[model samples]
Target: MTVYYCSASYYDNCDYWSTSNCTPPGTYCHRGACGTCDNSYYQCAWANLSGFPPENSIADTCGSSWLCNDKHAYDIPKFSCGTVLWVQDLCNDNGLNVTIADHGPYVCKCETNCNSVNLMRIIDLTEAAYIYLEGSFSRGHIPVMIQT
Candidate 1:
């Protein structure tokens, strides 16, 4: 598996669009727009995936039911879902164990924050995880080292 240590962000599962209204078979809805799935597993181009109850159409995806707790979301790819990961903040040496909850970094959208000379991957954390790592939400992004 590809391994790299990079920056990290945070996001909740609350923001998402329904795929039920999506017209094409290869696409899924996200943030109110229709986008193509990356593969048969329904992974979106932006890295988001489909598979949530109630809407049951699509979602940001999660590592476990507990990680979905609005405050513990981690937006790693689906391939990393359910995996225990170690993350250490490069700035302060603060670290914590996290699960791959969701998929993203949305590359283009995150721009320099998600990708840069020092930043390679973006691992979004939930409010709870961020707080646990002593991070400030206003900071937006933090440099971190992620390992499986």
Candidate 2:
């Protein structure tokens, strides 16, 4: 697996200088409120299988047709359009197979819903993934093991 880090320094200037979310030096800006940036760590790995949910209800960063049912987003480097991933919820030993359809959880200097309160979070899953794993989104963030 390949590991990647979102630079804290990149977020510092963007978060402090702009009243709204501004594009970082090397990344594109998506949907966000003012003074927000995503500063998180990420990685790439292998996948065992592919799975799809009953409903594709979320829009990704690119505004694609189908997302991973639970709105799973990816880091810029990891967003390969149709890449598959197997993610496990360390909190409950549950897992789900999903695809990279969006970009996000931008780790910024300030804390926000982007990272779900867990600064270590690399991938952001929507309600569907959480429900499939029988996890609570209110937990803010849960530890996870992901297989690309």
Candidate 3:
């Protein structure tokens, strides 16, 4: 149970740190040289199922509590946190259309007219086939929205 997000005037459960810090006793408010916000969880790093290196967040330590699992389920240092990428599993290539149609954001690719000259390469974050992302742990703060 480690969620730590502080700043609700002083984290006495200002809400949204994952169901009020697992319902318990808290008393930590410091948020400076590192953090403390009247305590409730905040010790990141661990959610690297062995494939997410590019500097997304990996320097862990902070424990109190935080957990959320829609069903695929996960909580506890249970491999840290943060993960979200479900564009139907990266556009389901099987049909060979990594992604293209540019006019509305679906211009992502790893192959297929993703550039033609074809070697498969064009992944700089572009998913607008209606845009829908929620894999990054998603507790709040989500903005890549493009609804047209």
Each candidate's clash count: 0, 10, 18
Indicate whether candidate 1 or candidate 2 has the larger lDDT: 1
Tens-digit lDDT track of model 1 for 24-83: 642444432222211212121213333423122113233334222132224343443455
How does candidate 3 score on lDDT?
0.21
Candidate 3 on 15-127: residue-level lDDT in tens?
A: 23323334353422222111211122321112222333323311122122221221111221122122222222222221111121111111211222222222111111222
- For candidate 2, the lDDT comes to 0.37
TM-score of each: 0.49, 0.41, 0.17
Task: Flag clash pairs in model 1.
Answer: none
C-alpha lDDT values of all predictions: 0.46, 0.37, 0.21
Winning model by lDDT: 1
Rank order (by lDDT, best first): 1, 2, 3
After superposition on all CA atoms, what RMSD does each candidate show versus the true structure? 13.5, 15.5, 18.1
